[model samples]
Target: MNKAQVVEAVVLAKKAKQLTWESIASTLGMSTVWVTSACLGMNSMPEQAAEKLCELLELPSEAKSVLMEYPTKAWSPAIPQDPLIYRLYEVVGVYGDTLKEVIQEKFGDGIMSAIDFSMEVEKQPDPKGDRVVITMNGKFLPYKAW
Candidate 1:
């Protein structure tokens, strides 16, 4: 498939799997909107971004190599002119309270930094519920001391 087609496929797969853009974007150290746009063919993936996308989607080596070539246009015509930040905001609208509680529980007072973080997922069996365990490690940056 072509670059746009590949991007579209990845985005569809992500949505089909019910994976959050924030989760994926945090792993890539990129804004959620950029990654979402890149995966939806709304924005071009630079060499590094393409590599990261390939890795995220587990694309084959050959397909990953092909994506590095510059495309004719930087973005697809179908993309809206308005910023995708609104879409991200919509996610917060749905889950903001739950996320805030979880974040506060995990890291105490501060927020998790997408910039300095890593994530790993593993399957764990449980009688109560089938579990998908996600572990995240981010550098904790305390607020400036007074």
Candidate 2:
């Protein structure tokens, strides 16, 4: 089966089993974000992890190998259409330069490495309104200059 089908099966199984990403990650002995991304086809899991996840989900045999295969990551829209996604796009449009400048100032001439990145999303309770908090940590890759 293709990665998309595998992801579909994973989602179905997750819902059917009422399993949290944290729980699955614990089973795989990995991070929640990485495990979730792997299941969603953005990253590849190791063979052992893939087998364990497939067994946990009771997925088709084809799913195990697919889950361990490297993925070619791409997004459909150049500019996102969904409201939440578009909001993130807008945030980049508005603060991209400021963020880049600050990051460079702090870290030197370097870029964040998505390949070695981790992200966490949390909900903060507030009296008037709850807040969505996102934290991203990544290795910094500096330019190789002569």
Candidate 3:
């Protein structure tokens, strides 16, 4: 099936199961807006996100594998005008610089490449402040010349 059909199917199933977008988004560690846009076909699902969605929705193995296939193009030709992606962009616009600086400080001169990483999160309790600790491990591979 196509992306839109997959999205529509998931949304329909979610509604029938009385599931909330917040629940799904939190489970996926994504913003509700992003999940919503993906469900409505306004945004394409990245492979990782698509795999998570397939698992959450209890799709068949074939469908799950299909959803995880890499797309031919890096970016979709049809950019979303959805409020969700727009709001995400607004958040990036406002806080992206601060986030970048913090990330650089923590990781030194490189990025945490999503393609080569694993992430785990845990909740830690403290008297002063409760914290959600996220640990990401990635292979540190420098770019090489051909």
Provide TM-scores for the models.
Answer: 0.42, 0.91, 0.44
* TM-score rank order: 2, 3, 1
lDDT of 3 by residue, 43-106 (tens): 5567777788778877655555445544443445464589876775777689888876777776
Candidate 1's TM-score: 0.42
Instruction: Report, for every candidate in turn, its global Cα lDDT versus the true structure.
Output: 0.67, 0.93, 0.67
lDDT of 1 by residue, 1-146 (tens): 77766766677767777779878778778877557655665455667767776777777665564555555545343534466646546667788989867877876766767557666656799999888765767776554556
lDDT of 2 by residue, 9-95 (tens): 999999999999999999989988889999999998899999999999899999999999899898786897889989999998999
> Candidate 3: minimum summed lDDT over ten consecutive residues — where?
65-74
Residue 3 local lDDT, model 1: 76
The reply for model 1, stretches above 4 Å from the true place, is 65-146
By lDDT, the best candidate is 2
Candidate 2 vs 3: which has more lDDT:
2
After superposition on all C-alphas, the RMSD of every candidate to the true structure, in Å, is 10.2, 1.5, 7.4
lDDT of 1 at 30: 81
Worst 10 residues of 1 by lDDT: 72-81
lDDT of 3: 0.67
- Candidate 1, residue 90: Cα displacement in angstroms equals 19
Regions of model 3 farther than 4 Å from truth: 20-65, 71-85, 116-146
Ten contiguous residues minimizing lDDT sum, candidate 2: 72-81
